[model samples]
Target: MKESIISVEGLSHKYSSSWAIQDIGFEINKTGILGLLGSNGAGKSTTMNIMCGVLNQTKGSVFINGIDLRKQPELAKKEIGFLPQQAPLYKELTVDEYLLHCGYLRQLDKRMIGKAVDEAKERCGLTHFSKRLIGNLSGGYQQRVGIAQAIIHKPLLVVLDEPTNGLDPNQIIEVRSLIKEIAEERAVIFSSHILSEVQLLCKEIRMIDQGKLVFSDTMDAFNNYVAAQSIRVEMDRPPAGEELLKIEGVTKVEFLTARSLKIYFDGDHEVTDRIIKTSVHHDWHLREIFFDKNSLDEIFAQLSNYTKSVN
Candidate 1:
């Protein structure tokens, strides 16, 4: 088994009377990106703060490479690099200058700061823009500078909060590629409201709603879970919901549009065959029929809505 680089157990936080997060726990045991997903006030920031040692959790513990965060704050933090939603940058400083300053702040030896700065710039594709002032660069380039600063000390884990929040489509693509490049040798924990971006970048996902974890699983497992329960059908003249429900394995039928239906059913391949046969028998002019697996966006909306209704 791979050793866990970071372990969070029973993590919780409260502000005065209201709780910000509750009993959050997870472990990163390998080099891969872990995505944190949630809505506007879903405690994503609180959780990241605790993990990065910005705010101590009201309860529970965090371990980075077997070192307790509370017991050895400096030692634990030495292995982490963090970039919040807003990239921290001094507009007047050049990329190289800022990275060198970061290396110094991390207490790197004076002799090693220049080499570390050069490597970080190379890794982030900032070597060409090394002498340009940060404020004069594009948003994508500035974000690269932020990431470069974060990794200047070569930390074992990097935490990023909404790294691609406000970029153009091209910039989003560029930054996403950069994130994958950085994750090649270390673990990355990032939070984003963009489901598609998370899907593209992360193998494992942790979704939170109302300060509570609602789902945590690998992307493949999540897709399989959705696929086992639903099927989508499109036809020129679709049958009634009542008629579709009468199919052998179907449990419910939802109309997406006049020509489309979403059918919920048991995980039986035969159900699909039955649906096709029924459409043919009715001369429904079937256009499409396939499993109605929920995308990560749909799943997030469903979970967040459920949390709101219950609360």
Candidate 2:
């Protein structure tokens, strides 16, 4: 297997008297998008901050591309590019000026600052906005500038914290595309509380809850593990709600429309197969059927309970 790009082991942190994150550990591959998922105040920020060397961890370790973050802060930081939840921008500065400043902050050679700034601007679709003041640009463009600064030094691992927060739908789409494009060459850690965004863009997921690593797995596995307790089916010729309830493992039925309904099951996913068979027998003419993943609250609660039980 290829060596990991980001390695975190027993990573932890405390704020004042309370633990913010505890025993969080995970690894990122060299290329692709990995989602750091959690609710607000779930310690996602603390973990990202520690990994990016912006905040210190009280216990554990973070290794960025094999360099110990805490031991060699400068060297380790050279391999990382970070965007906190809020985009750091000097509103008065034009895109060009801000990027040049960032290049300096990254300690790029004076001779390379211009080239690096241009390249970052081009990659982030900010070439045309180079002369525009950071505050004058739309929220989407400002976000692009933030991303541009993060990549000015061309780091190996980019950690983004809630990069899509508070953006219009169109802006969010544009930013998501930019992130995917960026990940093609380097590892990207996209953090968000939105489940659908992670489901749509990530290859793997590391979920934190109540300051602990509650779930870690591939995206497909997560889909399968959390879904199927409920399913929505649309049929051209549907049966009465009572008739459908006779199937084993079925718990409840919710009618959504004259031709559609949602089915809730206890545990046996085979209940879907049975429903299919029954539909065929009754000539219900099933048109569409798919399992519905639980709501974010449901998944969080379920995972939290499981984690506590394991501990």
Candidate 3:
């Protein structure tokens, strides 16, 4: 089995009496991308801070590559690379100088620092811009430099918070591709409020709401959750909502248009066949039928609302 790069257990943090995060826990194993998804003030940054040793948690333990963060902070932190929402850069420094400084700061041996800088620059596509001043690079190139700095020490785990936050569409695409490329070697924990981006990049997801974990599962499982609960039927003439609800196993019907209806139902393929047969018998012109899978945004909204209602 692959070794876990990071493990968080019962992690909680507070500022004064106000809790920033409560009982947040998860593990990153193997080489793949995981997403921390939440809205503004939902404690993503707080959880990240604790994980990266920037803030001590009020309770619980964090282990990076099996070293306890609270007990062996220096050793634990050596295994992590973090890129905050705002890219940390020295505007006056050239990309090469900045990355060299990062390598030295990470305590790489003088002999290894040059090799590390060269490798990071190649991986991040910054070789051509190595001599250029960071203040003169485009937003996308600057972000690449930030990423290069994070990986200069070859950490086992990378944590990126909203890496694409300020980029334009083309820049977002470039950064997204770069993130995926980096994850090919080390585990990555990406935090973002952009639902589509998370859906696109992450194989697993952990969603936070009101400072608590609301959902944690693989992407396939989340997709199955939406698929198992809903169906969509398109007909030339849709039945009335009451008539559709009368079908056994169907709990609700939402009319999407004059010809399309979204049906919520318990697990019963028989009920779907019945709907098809009924449509055919009534000359309703059944045109299409399929499961109505919820988008990540829809799932997030539902989970957030449920969290609010429960609290």
How many steric overlaps does candidate 2 have? 0
Root-mean-square deviation (CA) per prediction: 3.4, 2.4, 2.8
Clashing pairs in 1: none
Please give, for residues 73-120, the per-residue lDDT of candidate 3 as tens digits: 989888999998888899899998999899888999999999999999
Q: List the candidates' TM-scores in order.
A: 0.87, 0.91, 0.89
Q: Which is the winner by lDDT between candidate 1 and candidate 2?
A: 2
Tell me which of candidates 1 and 3 scores higher on lDDT.
Answer: 3
Write model 2 residue lDDT over 1-311, tens digit each, in one string.
Answer: 55579999999898899999999999986699999988888899999999999998999999888889999999999989999988999999999999999999999999999999999999999999989999999999999999998999999999999998989999999999999999999999999988889988998999998899978998877766665588899999888889989989888999999998999999788998999999999999999988887765577667878877886
RMSD of 3: 2.8
Q: Write one digit per residue (lDDT tens) for candidate 1, span 1-311.
A: 55579999999999999999999999998887999988778999999989999998899999999989988999999999999988889989988888888998899999999999999999999899989999999999999999988888888999999999889999989989989988999999989987888889999989888898888899776555444478888899987899988899999999999998889997786998998898889898999988866777767777778777887
Residue 114, model 1, lDDT: 96
lDDT of each: 0.88, 0.91, 0.89
Which parts of model 1 have CA positions greater than 4 angstroms off?
Answer: 1-3, 227-230, 234-274, 283-288, 305-311
Best model number under TM-score? 2
- Residue clash pairs of candidate 3: none
Candidates, ranked, lDDT: 2, 3, 1
